[model samples]
Target: MTSVSIAERLGQEKFLAQTYNRDFLHVPGAFADPGGLVSFNVLSDLIARHRLEPPRLRLTVDGETLPQHRYAVPVITRRNTRWDRVHPDELHQRLAKGASLVIDQIDHLHEPVGDLAASLEGWLRAGVQVNAYASWTSTEGFGVHWDDHDVIVVQIEGAKRWRIFGPTRSLPLHRDVVEPEPPPAEPVAELVLTAGDVLYLPRGWWHAVTADQGVHSLHLTCGISPPHTGARLVGWLADELLASDIFRTDLPIHAGPEAQAAFLSALRKEVIGALDDSGLLERYAAARDAECVGRLRPSLPYVQGVPADPELMVRLTTGRARLDIVMAEGETVTRLTGAGQQVDAAPAAGPILHRLLNVGWHRLGDLADTAGVSVADTAALVAELVGAQIATVRSEGR
Candidate 1:
């Protein structure tokens, strides 16, 4: 709801070290203009323009979903493709009667939410998905539940009550061997989130929410995936170890004890040597960052290449892009790695890469000026990145 960026709202240093993943924190009045972030009017636009259904656009009451027919009509196009076209009257009827509305992965559908998600992704160095929730009554939507990922809730308008019961298990994964115990009958904490408030709840925390303040409510939850764990490290090791013969060789399924023992011994040695490096974690993170499938968008109108148009805007679509310096033929070159591609550039382009890493769009002329590079060369670099899908270019409309 705030004009200030998500990173500013959440002081990155203090929150990450002292609280992130370990606890919950709530900041009141974090934003002043809640409507600017995401408002009732914006929700109306998204609902009217997009053909949403099921989990993407759902209506619920007391945690149970309303049937699709209750709020939308299935439309079959001439091509035989079908979609649920939302009927405004029926949808309003459901909302008026206490059903909560939810738009999942709204970041993809809405730009404001997308920017918020992107900023969080950049600062947290992890993926983020945002859902928009709106309610008109005290009816609960999902009941008391726990999410597999951490969330930052922004109350865009009105107020909502949250009952926190805490986590029954620590760091529960979506696909885990064991399920968490049921939350306690009584909540450990009860609070109301009003307009402009922000709340950070770690994954595995049990909580229930409702719009019980006699006013309609609209809020956004930016869900962030849990941090890389030891399990993730081992999983990554599996892929990295594929280059070694010990890992590539077939298992001794029918062989003698000595054969299996030797295979196991060699495997252990390889694994130990791989894990012995202190920089393994950093390398693993960098690999993941490079592969990040950022907000994939095609640069239309310029499919062939980007022209040297000074007013055009450009931005890196991925939040986890990594910029590194490498020695190339006795000279240092900058490597911009992201979205599954590595692009090596001249040293002067370092300034341009650094500028693009920041949140939001940058003008083509401005980026060129940042590095003192010619517009033609800058456009060439931008075209290469846009081709890779790690970054995007747009006209001055933004």
Candidate 2:
């Protein structure tokens, strides 16, 4: 089966260089089959099976979040533990009253959405979290609110109308000292998105959504983490500057004005020098990608070690993993860095790791053939990756 690449769906380099983090993009029928990734049936199944509580699963109307008691009740389980499960009758009533349903971090619970988010992370070089929204009425769920992080919204089931008021503040932060002023009275643009439509809204763009176009709406909003800021760069630079004695020395708190001025000048020069490097942003982005704490999954049954089974399937868990080749003592060494862990292996294993990083899944035999090694040796290498929580193995295809 052919796989749908999210990067291609979003227009790849064109979207990244032009529309990403700069302006809103509306792509009609971009998903073609959004239901393949998620659907109303999937949301129903999740609600019926999982013990989801407020915030993780919420009902909101007119910008106010409804309490859990409005739709769910606590029931004593057979284990004598109290669990809050969705009361279908109450949930229906609540929806009838114009409350929108929300499932936070749906990517973690759904495989297709998880893969979509991982693909986005690989393309955008930033972490992503996908939230599912289902609305039945024209009532707005969030009113005119702006997210701190940029969002790529995929309309999965129905139609939703969005009134977008462009940002009044420049790159607002969650913990900013000043709050963004109220949005303008009139929206800059209004868009109606139906099934298979995709929308990208940058952070700080105030928008209100409603499912009033004679149809209910179900959509997945993929929240991309905000880009690195100047503040963050300065913090990282401070740590990087510790190598200099001037930065390590104590502050001239009780010294004369001349001493304080000299100290300030020296500090400014150090910071400016670091900022002058043309590769500063590139280096910072690499560090962030290398340290991404990606989703973790356990390779069950093979608790101790992976066996040399030809049918076993393996894949990397982290999408933002980095592979580097280094020549040490006239011999090539390959380094795999990601998910807060680093692994070094012989150059022969580079092909195998690169394949796992890019491909969704590979059979042990295929990986062994790619690396030109025995199945047993390949299994051992995969076991090391599994131990580091960077990769997982399963008997069934994912």
Q: Per-residue CA lDDT of candidate 2, range 1-398, in tens?
A: 01235567677889879988899988887767778888889999999989888889999998899989888888998989997889999999999779999999998898888888887888788898999999988989888999999998988888999999999998898989899999999999999999988898999999999995647789999999856788888888888899999999999999999999999999999888999999998888778888886778899999989999989999888778889997767878898888888888898898899898773778999999998999999999999999888899999754
lDDT tens digits, residue span 1-398, model 1: 32235557777788788888898888888877777777888889988888787889999987799999998898999999988899999989999989999999988887767777877787787888889999998888888999999999999889999999999999898889899999999998888999888999999999999996768999999888756778988998898899998899999999999999999999999999998999998898888788787787777788999999999989988877889999978889999998898888999999999999876789999999999989999999999999888889889874
For each of the candidates, the C-alpha root-mean-square deviation to the true structure, in angstroms, is: 1.9, 2.0
Minimum summed lDDT over a 10-residue window in model 1 is located at 1-10
**Poorest 10 consecutive residues by lDDT, candidate 2:** 1-10
Against the correct fold, how does model 1 do in TM-score?
Answer: 0.95
Q: Note the Cα lDDT for every prediction shown.
A: 0.87, 0.87
- What lDDT, from 0 to 1, does candidate 2 have? 0.87
C-alpha TM-scores of all predictions? 0.95, 0.95
Q: What is the model-wide C-alpha lDDT for candidate 1?
A: 0.87
